[model samples]
Target: MENEMRSANTEPLHKPLGSSRTFPHFEGLLFSPVQLVKKSLADDVPVDIETKIGPHARRPLKLSMPIMISAMGYGVALSKSFSIALARGTAMAGTAFNTGQGPVLKEHRDNAKFMVVQYHGAFWRPTVHQLGQADMIEIRLGQGANAGAGTVVKVTDLPPDVLADFLATTHEMVDKPLKELVVPPGIPEIRTQSDLRQLIHHLRLAGHGVPIAVKLAASNYLETEMEMALRAGADVIVIDGAQAGTHGSPAILVDDFGLPTLAALCRADDYLRLNRRRDHVSLVVSGRIRTPGDMLKALALGADAVYIASAALFATAHKQVLKPLPFEPPTQIAWVNGTHASDFSIDEGADSLARFLTSSSEELKSGIRALGKRSLREVDRSDLVAWDSEVARITGLPLV
Candidate 1:
């Protein structure tokens, strides 16, 4: 009876999942600029910085900054130049980059100081040897948007090797009877969370390698899911909210089904406390972590660092406007194979990131000061005042 009841409760997740709802009808909450400033001034208190995740893991990873870039899979979200520019930005910010759900670009490995590589699908393969190179490898169960859904990448979105693999998989899967085969439009692999976990365990067992991570979309049973992930040997966990950006999938999937980042992070933090193993794993939060304040709030709530990507893409694209006349996003193909350049000669892009990181860090420190704190580690969940929802729910902010 208990098993039956649990199964009944889990069914809603099978529905076509969409953007996060931890703060339901979130769009209704945003207002004009002046109100933003006025509301920003309302908070008052000293931030309580705390170590929300395991001290051993956090110390080794050393993720101190609140904002880290969410990995948008290569091709769909960024080109080589775009990624390199983002790497430059992350370096400026003293943060890490979550490698999007694609093969780890060697250039990205060299360009970024810290990274989390996510294994997205079967066709997106990386050998254990490849896994050894990562600071951490994240096995993605589902991103918030298009949960239970996978993407179809245009040839343009895939690099040569990924393209070859996708074509081979598609061809192999195509011969099967329609009843026995199901493939997503843009992605060639059919991934289940169970499959992801199996792979995660293998990576964790690889001696001396960085820890293995698993990324999941938040659902009502998130606590259970997290516990299971921990049990499955995940050293780090990423709770990507439905509000997280995706280049593919129906618009409906983008707006419904999953929890928002704010709520998901809060729930994951709570889950850690419940299991008494919050200290055993590192918690990284992604899904619209655009600013330092977002990172600060998440860290105080329990996340170690925020993942980012979209913002850096825009930054790089805009800066590219000043590149050599008639700039097209550059490509790197190997000798006689069209290898693209990773060299970022344009100081504009790198300089922009440097300035943005410095300014944002300062702004974060100001928020800290208002709350009567010093370092980022000092900020805590209590330092925030949720004006929107009541105590029982994600607070709806008072539109200033």
Candidate 2:
């Protein structure tokens, strides 16, 4: 009877309709594996720091500082502004930066010391050629802010200069109004297991010999997915937590599906360790990693390095003076009942990000000194403690 029930449950889940335009549904919403993992664990620990992925490696990625600016993507953050901010900030504090998806602006590549270029689409220059340009190649399966939903892009996210550059490149007619910016999702054919294997091969074959990292949201059976990634040649895996913020995402998908950052880290670590590939790859955590304390906590919970995004933007924001947007009117569209917010004072937005980058970097460096660590790699689980392990246990975590 158990086998019979299991068999029944294994049937094709909400098969896609025969019609191209028609969609299918299980219960009118997307099905997620988070609901199952949430119910299975117990004894969650606040400090389960244990080196798991690529454990036997000689040295881990010695991120100068414990923090990084998680790439919010090209269209989400003004062209190259975020990267420039990181270059200055990371150089000051010492850390890595992510080259987010979307159009790869030239300026983003200019100053990046340790840039992780994300392969978002089929069109991305394969990692083989990009190895010299980036230290790490992060495979973005999904983001915590949206899980497997969509990438956020509004005209307001681009700087006037960048938009001008883009316009010239595409040769499309004229000014895009603040209210009429059409953020088109770049069409790509690179979202499959095979696609990942090819990219991994590219990274390994690159002249610079960069390590490849695959990123995923805590939306499904992560243990299962991560194992596949390891088998597919992943040198590192990034598990983005739900608390990770974004310019915008559909409320349902954003709020639903995926474990919080801490929870996902625990599961992924356990899986990698148990699989006996701990030394073969590494685990990095991301999503709202603002302070040294946050990075400290994540490391104590088994993350090799904690990635950040919003925090970096805070460092690079322009001080007070905002740049005005040239686009007269920006177009907007509603996706999944979610209205788009497009304010085109692009310069103002850039100014804020540039200023933010500076401030946040200083704050992070202070935290590192307080911890008595000269570099990010020196800070470990032993240097920190979880203040709320009991509360974590209440969430059904597997206590050590």
Candidate 3:
């Protein structure tokens, strides 16, 4: 009788699956808005969003604004055209563009004013000359999506020329579809803190005085990790939170790994302050930072700057995505080897992205002024108050 009653409560096997449950995201938290006195009375006065990263270094990296284009590799994640367009757009906006693990394209390097080259764990590491060309070097320890897991890509999926290049660089060949594939994972040499220190020393020399940054996924021991990175001589620390997106990461890794952006940012900040290195090493945060309000909130919470990837891609694709729509996801237009990849216009995409950055900076400046602050640096944690109890606790900010 109990079994019969339980069976009656179960849904039919033939019923279609419902929408997947929503995951916790940065959007769940709300930022306290500026409501009282204005910071700038002169509407003509432009807010100085210019920020200097790695100030203690011989050659510090500077930006016109606090926002930058995050790492998104060419061939692996996006096409050459998309990479070039983003580089051009970021250059126009006076911001930096990061070249992810994939081999760097000359077009992107030529177009971007400030290029941050990523040294990944993959076999596709760049040559010393290539590394020297970058304005900044980021040693990628891990990412928010698929933190420690390896990622595989089939050779057949790549174009003929791209496949040949990858083969030559990695000295790898495909015997069969499933048996042989391109896989990238954590750097084998960096199993200990001592190894990380050696890598930082090598990169510092290879980068030709350019700032060397260490990128790590936000996890429970992020503070401890940051300490090691700083001790290893990293000029900047990039914390990628759970809300961060990836082009082709596994669903399980994306959904289940890393700490949220709020928690990660607060913990890193607290650690830096405790060590009296708050002003020594710059902290850059990346996750699901969508709106200008989100960027402002992150900056106020102690982030020196913000790294934007998915948002930049969307801005670059802009109206171009419409061309591929009704048939595929918008990213299909941006992805390498996508059916519509060739259809994307670099000129149009670059223009759209530049406008997006400019407008977003303006909005952020408005928010800064609303808080009675003249500069982005003036907008600190004191100006912020969280509406959600969980967010308040996670960020260590006051509750509204």
For all predicted structures, in order, the TM-scores are 0.70, 0.63, 0.90
Give the higher-lDDT candidate: 2 or 3: 3
lDDT for every model? 0.57, 0.53, 0.80
What is the Cα root-mean-square deviation between model 1 and the actual structure?
9.8
Tens-digit per-residue lDDT, 1-400, candidate 1: 3356547774322222133444542332322222333333334433333222323432245543556666655544444555565666667666666666544567677777766666655444455555666666677777777665765444553556544433432323444322211223322332444654576657665424466777787777788788777876677888888677664455556766677777787778887878798767888877766666665666667777666654554454444433432444332211111233333443456567656666766666666666544556655555554435542266423332
Best candidate per lDDT, number? 3
Minimum summed lDDT over a 10-residue window in model 2 is located at 16-25
Q: Clash number for model 3?
A: 1
Task: Encode model 2's per-residue lDDT on 174-204: one tens digit a residue.
Answer: 5445432333232245556686677677665
List model 3 lDDT by residue over 348-374, tens digit each.
998999999999999988887766667
Q: Ten consecutive residues with minimal summed lDDT in candidate 3?
A: 12-21
